[model samples]
Target: MERLFGRAWLVLGHESQVLAPGDFLTTRMGREPVIVVRHVDGSIQVLVNRCAHRGSRVCEGPRGHARQLVCPYHGWTYATDGTLCALPLAEGYDRSPIGVEELGLRRVPRVETYRGFIFASLAPDGPSLLEFLGPLRASFDDLVERAPAGEVEVAGGVFKHAYRGNWKLVLENHNDGVHPAFVHASSIWAARNGAPWDVWEKTGLWVARYGHSWMGDYHDDTRLVAALDHPVFREYRAALERRLGPERTARVLGELRWNSLVYPSCSFMSQFRQLRIIHPIAVDRTVVHAYSFRLKGAPQQMFRDTIAFANVVNGTASPVLTDDLEVYERVQDALTASRNEWVELGRGHGGDVPDRDGTLRGRTGTSEIHIRNQLAAWLEYLDMGGPEGRADAPAMAPQSAQRSEAPRQSRNAPRPA
Candidate 1:
């Protein structure tokens, strides 16, 4: 945790969660509780939630508006910016060398936002958030641009669930295009009468630096957001065209990307306007918070579609998600009992080609290249002797050039039957 999450930028929440001064949301940055609050100065502050007087966490609720943070233990109070403001029995510390000014809740070393998504880092120095995001910034652009008013905000509350599995499993599963056919077979069989699937054929996989990856649109307009001819969709498109013009609107709507991973933290679907943040509690336990976004100027039906998709895919009662949760737990159990240290991820190995944008494109969407890319990043961040260890080191090199070295087992292994 210290090496991977402590040193890396992790998404906290969206800027919309704390729009006004004193608006605040409590979340975890890899198990450490923290508060993302808007200050009186009109700036966002990421403060450690632990009270200064003692170690008790200050914020218990998920989110709210607060003029100041008061510790429940001893009534020690702090301002929205994390300044230590008041505390009980102040005269007791009169003779102490340390003053109350030195006891403010520790602020996260760095905080940044890109396109209303907030991120904070515990490390004092490293690559800026922009450099860490690399080309994945375009994924956020794709999301916000779909908003007719050129902005998006969190809506419809959150869908939260806990699974008895490692957090990495879900992150890996999201971009593993091969799993939905089998993992979601029950749901598919009930919905589609067991039709043969060919989602990967239309999808493209792209991997970027710093472990970021995303899948191109697998579902066409007809399946993705109702038919392009649907009246609500037509209205949504008209609204976008007014702001972005007809040509730009056509280009935006034409782009079809699905799940995108921002590495070590969050995965989101621009098509459905859903964002899921992963929180690791222990090696065998994980929690996820799923949120839906509303396009600023889009029709109400559009947001309704977002909610319906969330219920079907991300909600706790979702058969699709429950299927995945069961599989994740089973995999975790198997992994705990297995003797082998290595799990193969060789699908489409050595077949990824470089794209014009400096990213690697998988030969097929079914490739496990996304998982491999994530593991490579995991190794990089965990390596105390690697670039992440040094304060001045540059970000990891693009994984495209590293694909030449295939795993030894993959070279000699027989193709799967």
Candidate 2:
């Protein structure tokens, strides 16, 4: 955790969760608990939830509006900005070198927001959030620009689930492209006769620097934006056209990206308006929080469709999600065996073509290039020297299995949002 999430920029929550002064939501940076609050000064603060006095957690609830944070264990009161304001029996530590002024909650070193999504980093210094986001910022733009009012907010609450599997499994599965055919066979059968396997051929799989990757939409009528004949969808499009004009509206809706991974912590779908944050608790356990967004100024049915998509695809009761979860646990269980020492990620190897935009595109949509790119970034973050010097080198396939030339291309290529 210290090497991966501890030093990386992680998503805390959305700005809407703490919009008003004193509104706060509790989340975590890896395993360390944190409170994201809106201060009276109108600034957002990400503070450690541990009390300054005895290291007890000051905030217990998931979310609330509070004037100040008070530890139930010792009744130590702290201001919204994390300044220690009051404590019972002040004479207890009269001679101690530590003063009340120094007991405020420790603020995270850096906090930044892209659009309405907030991110915090525990590390004191590194690449700025924009530098880290690189080309993936367009994914966020694709989401927010869909709203006629030019904003999107978290809505319909959040769906949280825990699984007995490594956190990396979920991120890898999001863009695997090959798993849904077998894993979601039941859901496909129930929805219709079978899956549209041909959609894979039309979609594009893109991998960028920092392990971020996204796939183009299926472009079939089953997509969220494909209901052109529905009056609600027409209204929604007209609203967007009024705000963005015909040309910009065409460009915005023309974006076909589906699932986008902001490496290490976040995965989102622009079309369905769903955002999920991955929280790693232990090596074999993880929790995910799924949130649905409501586009401002869009038709009410649009938000309803967003909720329906969440319930059908992301909710705990979802057949589609449960199938993936079961597979995750099964994979975890089998991985403990001593039989296999390496996980092969060589599907579509040597077939990732270079794009003019500097990203590596899988030769086919069903390739495992996304996983290889993610593991390469994983090694970079852990500072484990490439496959040559690492002790656990056998755990991975090989360095040549990944697209090594793409980074050189990315370094000099112009980043397109």
Candidate 3:
């Protein structure tokens, strides 16, 4: 894998993470360490956390409010905008070119906000946030608007997990609705007491354009739909109706069950009200952050149900996800061996019918079409000159994996539309 910024989506943090002035957050995209801060003037900024004086990290904590990014080594202070606003000594050297302006922290090439979510791009060129989001914008709007209060906040903290496999596997898993019936057969069966879950039969699986796709929509399936029709969903719909009116409530809630993948590295399973982050630490080892979201103005039980679902399905302790983790780990270990250069993606080969917007649909949930969609985005990033290219035109490429093996490509790889 290559680290090309243009070919892939690199910026990952959202604006809501830093709400108050002086609020700061530390995170990494691809390989760059980022510092997101709400400056004194109440504006948000993203800059490289490395200090100009010496190549040392400026921010030490995950998140906090700070007076300034004080480099503890020499007490060098920088403003939230990455400007070198203060110095400890007046005259350390007679003739120094280290002017405050020259020594300001290096800011990322691009930064922007959508709704309240903040994002930064280390690369200078590619799709703007709106262009990049594509169909995802509507899904995100629904995620926030469906709430009675029309706002969402991070809650229940974040759960960090690791898998000994490529981060792409997680993306493939997220857009893969078919796997639940088989990969999660144990849990699904147990949930249904050995009876075949009807939702499994009539799953409303969809693979949308631009690498966005979803699984797990059987809300109308008489048997499996019963699960969501319970008091929790009913109350949620009622509250939403009061806030947005009957039409809007029906539009958001009764529309669909969307467990979606945001191209490159984000997952929002709307039903669960959980958002997961996939941070590629290394080719083989990836970090997963599962954050719970509270629907603003929704009932306490609604929020509690969101948390419970996170714990029951997406949490590290989840019976369903534990098996997934194990499978991912196993896949990583096995791919290291020498047998073939390509992994199997022929599950629904030649059968994917093109959707209205050029997205390909699979015959069933287990089809590898979702993985194919993700790899299309991955390859596009690689083709764009990836992270190693010049500053003017960034390219997208996969960050290299630790072990050496020819990067696999599918035999029936669809021509990306």
lDDT of all predictions, in order shown?
0.83, 0.83, 0.69
- Residue 240 of model 1 has an lDDT of 96
TM match of model 3 to true structure: 0.85
lDDT tens per residue, model 1, 22-60: 999999998689999999999999999998777999988
Record all residue pairs in model 1 with backbone atoms less than 3 Å apart, i.e. clashing: none
Residue 410 miss distance in model 3 (angstroms)? 13
Estimate candidate 3's alpha-carbon lDDT, on a 0 to 1 scale. Answer: 0.69
lDDT of 2 by residue, 127-160 (tens): 7888778788889999999999999999998999
Best by TM-score: 1
Q: What is the TM-score of each candidate against the true structure?
A: 0.91, 0.90, 0.85
lDDT of 3 by residue, 1-417 (tens): 334432455545556778888889888766777798998898888888888887789898788888878987887788889998776774775755245566888887788877566777676775677766765676678678867888887788777888888888888777655566678788877888333445453555556544667665444322343465777666766788888898877667665655778777788766557888788888899888888888887778878877888898778789988888988998899898897876776666556655544345566655676776666555545543542334554332235321111222322223322
Q: Which sections of candidate 1 miss by over 4 Å?
A: 95-101, 193-197, 222-228, 385-387, 391-417
The CA lDDT at 287 in model 3 is: 86
Ranking of all predicted structures according to TM-score, beginning with the best and ending with the worst: 1, 2, 3
lDDT head-to-head 1 vs 3, winner: 1
